[model samples]
Target: MAAIELRNIVKVFSDKRRGRDLLTLDNINLDIEANDFVCLLGPSGCGKSTLLNIIAGFEQATSGRTLVGGKQVERPGSDRGVVFQQPTLMPWLTAIDNIAFHLKLKGVGKAERHHRAMEFIDLVGLRGFEHHHPSEMSGGMNQRVGIARALLMNPSVILMDEPFAALDAQTKLEMQEELVAIWQKRRCTIVFVTHSVDEALVLGNKIVVMTKRPGRIREAVNFDLPRPRDITSPEFNDAKRHILALIREESTRLAQAS
Candidate 1:
């Protein structure tokens, strides 16, 4: 069975000011295999983030079902970990403390919590900066802390909503490389949402392209490109060309409708 399943899902939002209901997602279905890195890629208005939110149990679908690890996802649970666009770390706590806060909530002792979090701190390359607070760290560093926090949960699935979207180009590339390495080592299912084609191609083995508002799955392209992918290779360029064509077609269709 698939590690994650979205069966005929639909999401609608009531636009109070417009006095109408907006259908954001329509009859979407997807199956993600274990340890697969899937990227939900689309334009800004696409429901990619909404889909991630549904999987995270942060939003309810208007219809259909969501199952993760053979269980219905009715609410948020420790079985799934999430990393949002922003770090959202606690200002007062140090990086290590923030990473192990979940353990603290479950009554773990400070010594044990720190010890456990230390592994993830090293995993994310924040070894020497473990004691730094959010304010003391750069955006990328805080994001690493957020990722470590999520990893420490040992969840079956990790949901990321453009976690590196706000970083500088160089920082973003570094984080992407590190994320792919961590995903490979950890061997956990990851569903990442992003608007960047390059970002999606870089990180995901399976790229699920989504259409604009009233979102539908355009295609789920299986990349299977070798790890430490050569972005400049002909194969990579070919894949990029195909994806760009799909996006252009979608944009043209939308233009005609308007």
Candidate 2:
């Protein structure tokens, strides 16, 4: 069974200023299998984040249905972990505390929470920095803390919204590799949203291309490229070429409409 399912998802926003409605998503039907690293790829404002949010139960679609783990998704739950574009960590909380925040919310005690979160702190490579606050850490480091916090929940599905978009190239690449490694060992479903073709190609086993708003699926290309992928490999370039053409067409069409 699919870990997460969206059947004919539709989202419409009221635009009173224009005296009209804005259709943001149209008939979005997607089935993400368990342990798949699926990237929602598209240009900016294509409702990629909106789709992720719907699945996360942070935002509601105007119509249609979303199911997570064979149950209807009516609201957010600890089962679905979300890491937004920014690391929205509490400034005053220490790294370990931040990672354990959810557990704390569940009424888990201090010692137990710290013990459970320590493993993730080390997992995200923030061992010594556990005592530090969000302001005391670097951008990448804070993002790691954010990720660790999500993982500490042991979520069956993790939703990411361009989590690395703000990082420097080197740091972003490092995070990508680390994330891949984490997914490999943990075996959890991940839906990552990004606009960069290369980023999606490098990270996702399946790439779900989306169109301009009222975002619809353009293509769902599956990649067989081996892990620790060589970006310059012939097979990699061939796949890139196909994805780029689709993206180029999308950009042109959106530009004309706007």
Candidate 3:
């Protein structure tokens, strides 16, 4: 059985001022197998983030079903970890404290929480900075803390919505490499939402392209290129070209329709 399943999922929102309902997702069907790294790639406003939110249980689909580990997803649970675009770490809490905050809420003793959180802190390469507050860290470092916090939960799936979008080019590249390494080590299912074709290509073994507003899956492209992918190679460029063509084709179709 697939690790995650989406069967004819649809989402719509009320546009109160406009006196009409806006459809954001239209029948998004997908099956993500265990340990699959899937990237949802699309243009802006394509509902990629919305789809991610639905899977994270932050939003309910207007219709159809979302299942994870053979169970329906009704609300946010610890079985799924989510990392947003912003690190969203507490400004006052030190890195280690923030990462272990969930454990604290569960009434775990400080020593035990520290022990468990330290494992994730090391996993995310934040050993030396564990005592620093979010304000004391760089954007990349704070994001690392956020990732550690999520992983500390030891969830079966990780859902990320453009978590690296805010970093500088070099920092973003470094984080990407670290994330790929972490994912390889953990071997967990991940559904990452991003608008960048290159980012998707670099991180995902499976890429699902979505159409413009009222999003639908255009195609699910299997990318089996080896790890530490060469972005300039023929295979990489070929995949990029194909993905771009799909986006362009969708754009042109929408333009013509309008």
Candidate 4:
């Protein structure tokens, strides 16, 4: 059974200044399988993030339906965890506390919170810095905290909106590797939104490419390239070329229409 199902999902934003309704997404339908690493990839303004938000229940669809775990999503819940581009952590709290904050909010005991958070801290390779505050950590470290926090929820689905977009190239690469490792080990469904073609290729087993504004799925490419993917391999380059062509064609089509 599919972990997430989007049936004819559409999103429209009111453009008060323009006195019109701008269609952001148009009839998006997709089924993400359980334990799938699916990347919603497209150019900027393609509404990939909006689609992810709808799935996460942060935003409602203007029309159609979104289902997670065979149930309709009406509001955000613990079944889904979201990681934004920024590490939205509590600056005053220590790493372990930040990670266990959600449990604390639910009235979990302090001993249990630390015990559970410690597992994720170790999972994200932050075992030594559990007491460090956000101010004392680097961007990569804080992002790790964000990821660990989300993971601690043990959600059925994880939604990430360009979580590594702000990191340095080296740090981004490291985080990507760590994330893939975590996903492999945990076997949870993940829907990640990214504008970078290479980032999608590196992180997703299934790449759902979206079109320009009034977004539609251009194609859903299934890439089973082996882990520790060689970026320069012939198979990798071949796949990249195909995806680039699809995006280029979309751009050209839009240009001609304009």
Clashes of each: 0, 0, 0, 0
lDDT by residue for model 3 over 95-163, one digit each (tens)? 999999999999999999999999999998998898999999999999999999999988999999999
Please provide, for model 4 over 1-258, each residue's C-alpha lDDT reduced to its tens digit, 9 standing for 90 to 100: 699999999899999998999999999999999999999999889899999899989899999999999999999999999999998998989999999999999999999999999999999999899999999999999999999999999999999999999999999999999999999999999999999889999999999999999999999999999998999999888999999999999999999999
lDDT assessment of candidate 4: 0.95
Q: What C-alpha lDDT values do all the predictions have?
A: 0.96, 0.93, 0.95, 0.95
Question: Per-candidate RMSD vs. true structure?
Answer: 0.7, 1.3, 0.6, 0.7
- Per-prediction TM-score, please? 0.99, 0.97, 0.99, 0.99
Q: Is candidate 2 or candidate 3 better by lDDT?
A: 3
Candidate with top lDDT is 1
Candidate 1 stretches greater than 4 Å from native:
none
lDDT tens string, model 2, 108-154? 99999999998998888998999999999999999999999899889
Local error of candidate 2 at residue 103 (angstroms): 1.4
